[model samples]
Target: MQRKVLVIEDSAVSMNLVTRLVQQAKLMPICAATLTEAKHLFSQSNPEEFLCAVVDYHLPDAPHGEAIDYAIASFVPTIVITGRLDEETRTHVLSKEVVDYIPKENTQVYDYLSRLLARMEKNKHIGVLVVDHMRSSRTSMASLLRRHNFETFEASSAQEGLDILHQRDNVQLIVTDFKVPDMNGTQFVAELRKSWPKEQLAIIGVSSGNSALLSARFIKSGANDFLQKPYCHEEFLVRIMQNVEYIENVETIRRAANSDYLTGLPNRRHFFYSVNHVARTSPALQSVALIDLDHFKRVNDQFGHDAGDKVLKEVAKLIANHFSDHNVSRFGGEEFCLYFANVAAEEVDKSLESFRRAVRERPIRHQQQDIPISASIGVTHQGRKNLDAMLAKADELLYRAKSSGRNQLQSDLLA
Candidate 1:
């Protein structure tokens, strides 16, 4: 249990005793008596050097909450320990949302701290799912995953994995055997790619027999990684964590490029890219719409920018609430867009009618006053060849909606 812990205690004598306790638990303890000392210590050490922190409230420099905030900001789980404080103060300090709180004067502080640190050590691990055709292989792989503190599950077949996904939700990863009954792992993953979130799952397809082109096929069918069976435990753990981290990194990158931080909606770039992809890939009918709030500038001028932001968010909620099935995006300030793939042109009218009714029925009240907001939509279906052409046509129809009437939908609406 060679874990690292930062112990912040004001009393040097108490610090010495706690240090010994941490050492006895087989942990590396870093001691700091004050907020300044803890800050300096953290700023100087490598991130990988420390696992978590045990902070003290009422440090000499700053009292309560500050240390907790700083430690949490540094991505360390913090436990606040204090003595010579009343119950109110202890409750107040604990209320600061630190991971845990304790009294140093209590007889059980050392035992409690030991248990907390051990729990943290065990929790910072990857989760794995082992899918194998044979029971012996499944158990073997699950044991290998568990040795590294991973919470692992097992499935005997690919179809069983589909059932397992329904039963288990926290599973962030899958390590499936290449060959299985009913559906092979590759085919099963291909089906999974349609519904499940590809970015959230770190899939490792395993193969024991004929490790030839199967690995490449797995990667092609949406598996993020591969592992040859009879793998060494260390190699397996490393590879599994690597893929987990890789998926998280890719998601971070995609979010940076595609998401709006303000309303937490897809940005214009993401909207455009998705529209194009669906247009090129799906031969099924689809519709694209450019939606704009009417008299949005007036709302901003009347309500101040903050209130205007609230209204935009409110409208976004309306769009999401009313058209939950459609892919929606915020196209900059007061402007938005939507894509309904695989819907007929005539059906688009009925859907948009329902969306319009929903928005009109709901009122956005701010400061006890109802602020009316309505959108003009320019919608068009792809009879056209490419996505760009559909967008151009939708924009034209959108212009017609805005020019003709503010609260209306137009087809071939663009000027």
Candidate 2:
């Protein structure tokens, strides 16, 4: 389900800007220009659908922060925006347990609001580990993380933190105090690096001491960033967001590099990499199939390239679904490769036949035109040879399938 962010702004320009930003962040935005309109929108939608809200403190219908109060009462995390901020408004907004307040003095404030919305969307899926020897400090950090909608784990000592990391594989960010039992902050960070590298996970060290040397030591020990113990809420969140964003960016780049743009399947390089890893780890029998679309160029030449692309995407979807449990990749244009993790040689024929039947039955529909599609598949079960040798055998059979007749399945096991 898509999470919606409620935006209540009286200004048309700001409302449009904020809505665009929300959509750019890939979140659905429910916009209202007045407090009465907001109420109507809320009445029509489910409260649980909203992840958070960006509420302007002053609205034409409800002036003097009434919208903020109502949003808080509805139990939605809010980032309040106001044209001006004074002591009274600040105190009132904070007292209502709003996430943060931003003074809308310039264009940059809207950018800040956009960033806050982005963080709220991401925070729901990220897990942070808080490490501190003192119970008070640990609880404080955990509470803050929870308010930001992050999953949090607590550790009273450095060794316990490491143990938690070993147990919970999903921990992405770590916040540790400078003073910890069993191992100090610098040593703890150094030990964490032995297993989890900076790209995989991020660590932030916090120290109460005024010594600048502690910050340098933490960085030297592989911590991504450092924070002073007495830090403001905004500063803490900024550091955490920066590190988390970096880790996510690296993952996004890796996925883009390994994925096929047209079909959303793994590319040829990734397929080979996965095969090598499986060869090293698994001793069970596996099967590899090389698939080629029959008369694919004719589809492009007759129906045009766009129609051909639609056929390819539809065929890829069918193949992926038929072999949902296996590794599937687009080896190149109109050619796909599938790797079955574990299966007996006898069962390979039945599975490949099922896929062939499905492909034959389904037609690719594009621009009010239905195009028939078919494929020739060549499968080879593992033998006393390397992956490359097994793939060579499969390719050889694929050629036989094409030469004998199109839209058929040929297997080495049959030979």
- For model 1, the superposed segments whose C-alpha errors exceed 4 Å read 1-127, 131-151, 155-171, 174-246, 282-284, 413-415
lDDT of 2 by residue, 88-196 (tens): 9777776666777888778887777777787886787888999998999888778777767888999998878988998987799999998998889999999999999
Candidate 2 Cα errors over 4 Å, as ranges: 26-45, 59-66, 85-96, 282-284
Give the winner by TM-score.
2
Instruction: For each candidate in the order shown, give its overall lDDT on alpha carbons.
Output: 0.76, 0.87
Clashing pairs for predicted structure model 2, backbone only? none
**C-alpha TM-score for every candidate:** 0.52, 0.91
Score candidate 2 by lDDT.
Answer: 0.87
lDDT of 1: 0.76
